[model samples]
Target: MYLLILGLLMALLKFLEFGFLAEVSWWWVLVPFGLAALWWVWADSSGYTKRKAAEKIEQKKRDRIEKHRESLGLHKRRH
Candidate 1:
């Protein structure tokens, strides 16, 4: 997935001339490249977003449980 995205980005960058999209006789090619770029960004960002969100939730739960245990002055002992 990453490879394909990188490839498309490279292609688009190569196609651009002087910081502008090259005027291609066939315009339809631009559509796929644009879509690919959008997909790549969305895919990359969503994974990190989900991971961070999950970590935040887990940490909150852990903190709450720890606070509860501390208030009770209880801990598990291994002997």
Candidate 2:
């Protein structure tokens, strides 16, 4: 995400001929975008994305269950 944002900022700067970015090649300005793409491919193939998504879903489920229990006045007792 950061890489993409940075790349976009650089691209915009280059397009507007601002600062030193004005002299930079378009290919250089686009490097961050390429890196971001590679990172996404690696993360997806390594299951990192799926694991994070699964964890998020599990957390939501737990939160919903807790809310339901509270609504029913069914709280867990501390030992």
Output the number of the lDDT-best candidate. 2
Model 2 C-alpha lDDT per residue in residues 1-79, reported as the tens digit of each score = 9999999999999999999999989999999999999999999999999999999999999999999998998979689
Question: lDDT of all predictions, in order shown?
Answer: 0.67, 0.96
User: Which residue pairs clash within candidate 2?
Assistant: none
Question: Model 1, 1-79: lDDT tens per residue?
Answer: 5556655665576466423344433354446666667876886777965787889999999999988987898856569
The residue-level lDDT of candidate 1 at 12 comes to: 70
**TM-score for all models, in order of appearance:** 0.39, 0.89
Model 2's number of clashes is 0
Q: Name the 10 consecutive residues with the lowest summed lDDT in model 2.
A: 69-78
